[model samples]
Target: MRSIQRLVTLGAAAAAVVVLGACSAPSQEPSSATDVPPVPTVAAAGPTTPAVPGSTTAAEVFGPGCASLPTGDDPGSLSSMRLQPVAAAVETNPELTTLNDLIGRANLAGPLNAAPELTVFAPTNDAFAKLPAEQRAALEADPARLATVLEYHVSGTRASAEELRAAGTSTELAGGQVRIGGTGDAMTVSDASGGTANVVCGNVPTGNATVFLIDTVLVPQA
Candidate 1:
């Protein structure tokens, strides 16, 4: 009877070891496909947006004459041109030689240099050349009259392309009104005598003021 009991106890111990071994073993069953998490998708980059229509940019203010402007490295360039005052800046441009001569003769260069925030509508040499010889001589002979004519070309306030367009008319130091018309490359300025000048080069910034090189000399009414 005792021998039979020992055999039964040994069989029970063997069955418990098998159960423990199965429990301790790693899982062999395959995982479900849904058990893994999905990865997030990345978005592709897009192109830049363009500028708004009808808006005036800095390039627009420079006008078409900028095509003839010297590069920054050139001594004659507008970038180098700004290093000096307006009077000195004008002297650097070969095209404005006549204007420079007139400014010096009239003794207006000193005053122009001293003036703050002035907008000068400088006429090219061709403009002065277009004037009748007798009239030109008479004006040149009289410094006071020449000064008046020169002052008529200047405004106390600095006028940009957009400002001139918005104003339509600007009051000058000569106590006369200058009519500003058109937009962009077609912009024109009219003096008291109804003579109009095309802005060849607009918005040339200097140390003291902005300069617009016009194609015609502006004459104030007597």
Candidate 2:
């Protein structure tokens, strides 16, 4: 009877141990991997500013002629003009009719179109009209001379209004230096002849060049 009781007690203890071991055992089923929250993805930072093809920022259209500029809907606006080459861009502006004609006559349209980058100081029709009759006749009579005069208005690089203001001077294709002055809307460009032309509408971007519409034709020194 004592042996039987001891055997029974041992059997009970073994059964309890088995129950506790079963309770403490780790779960065998697959973990809830799908139920777990996923780590969040981070996005990369963008450039502080995406650079426009020409000009630092959208230019503030200025001067007396600003009123005459094409409205936002017009095809002649800077946005639309930039799609065309410099010569074609100038041709679209009625205010620059004289300059456009001269460009055509001088056969400078080709060169201007071909140039990778340029800054053209385009004189208005009024500017050309202001030139002495003799000077106009001489230019019309001499295509080569007219071409040189036209070249005087161009820089080999794209020069925006801010750039011109910062540089204060730019060498023209005609081998003459043009002096730039003032800040912002008051910017001016002086030719070798000491004549100053106000940049009426500046930072005009075109396909091949940046154009600054001026009030006077730039004349190169002899």
Candidate 3:
């Protein structure tokens, strides 16, 4: 009877072992298909935004544009011919003082300022003094003669040295052509009488005219 009991206990132990092994076995296996990368897609096109246009800027004017028009601090910018830059130029240049006075006497102040543009060939004081005393006395007595002689030096346009070179002849207000000659600083001009006026000072711009201080007076043509 003891042997029969022992055999039954061994059979019970073997059954428990089999049950534990069944519980330890895996229920699922790993997937065989590898994860594929997501497929790339093209970006969709959209309506483009319009660009802004560019703008233009206006010119700026500073201070007083007409500051040089009257009896301002600027010497050569005055509108009155007597008070104009030519006056200052002659006043300051010791050699041209007599010419300055002559201009005043000839009553050229108003006309010079009234003109839109003019070129003046200014003769020096020495040039006038170099004239014979009788001729000088004669000119002083006749204002019209003095005026005509002064007008002979004036052109209707404000011509620069470069402009004078380009055109050999510039018509004078006295109804004759003044011949431009030479080049550079040595440039000279010949009057209708063949007298040469050397350009002592060139391109002196005024409120209404341009002046070139010359060493000799221009003799007008008949």
Candidate 4:
């Protein structure tokens, strides 16, 4: 196991270098732990189960994307966010900067955080990047349109992974229906935009909502 130990040491050294570089970098809107692009998911230091509704146990968070989050109890970590409102929790998640900024611009964070129960299909920066240029530009340019699009990603009822798969669909806050398919990490969501988004990391939790990081933005239908 000498090679394995060496690899681990090398990995830690590489991570330290990155941390040092980021610490020395110019200030912008402060980001989650690393400035390096994060995979499409939010904070978690470990994996957990996704099928339990209304549970925010740190041990209940799951998905392949979990590994990318910064470890420990920083404001950006899963354990720290377990008691915070969904909108508040997203504020410190690295992969969700684009979504966080849009929510701020659209002024939807208040409603999202205040809602008693919700299931948020949060899109990552990469997801926004993948959005068609004209569509993304239009949404960004108009707060009203952006609000509708953002609402389209949320459900009024909080649902666990099994519940989502069992129901097959949910009505979004935008008053439109979205179809949910697959189970756990393989789950996918489809909206009126006719594009499908995979749930890269499923069953994340906050005080008032269950969060799922999706790989695509869900556009609202007319």
lDDT of 1 by residue, 65-140 (tens): 6667677656546776666678888888877899999988987776677554567888988889999999999999
Candidates in order: C-alpha RMSD to true structure: 31.9, 28.2, 43.1, 19.3
The sequence of per-residue lDDT tens digits that candidate 2 reaches over residues 1-222 is: 222233335556877899999999997654686765566888897754314444433354556665666766466677678788888888888788898899889877766765656788899888898899999999998988888888888877776777677788998877879999977578899988889999888777777678888888888998
lDDT of each: 0.75, 0.76, 0.61, 0.78
Task: Identify the candidate with maximal TM-score.
Answer: 2
The superposed Cα distance between candidate 1 and the true structure at residue 212, in angstroms, equals 0.7
TM-score of 4: 0.73
Error of 1 at 29 (Å): 78
Model 3 clash count equals 1
lDDT of 2: 0.76
In model 3, which runs have C-alpha deviations exceeding 4 angstroms?
Answer: 1-94
Worst 10 residues of 2 by lDDT: 1-10
Residue pairs with colliding backbones in model 3 are 76-85
Model 1: how large is the Cα RMSD against the reference? 31.9
lDDT of 4 by residue, 1-222 (tens): 222233335546877899999899986654666666645877676755444354456665777777776568877678766778888999988988899999999877766666657788999888999978998888889988788788888877788776788888888867778899976568899988798998887778788788888888887787
lDDT head-to-head 1 vs 4, winner: 4
Candidate 1: segments with Cα more than 4 A from true spot: 1-61
Better of 2 and 4 by TM-score: 2
* True-vs-predicted CA distance for residue 30, candidate 3, Å: 79
- Model 2 quality (TM-score): 0.74
**Deviation of model 2 at 159, angstroms:** 1.4
Report the number of clashing residue pairs per model.
0, 0, 1, 0
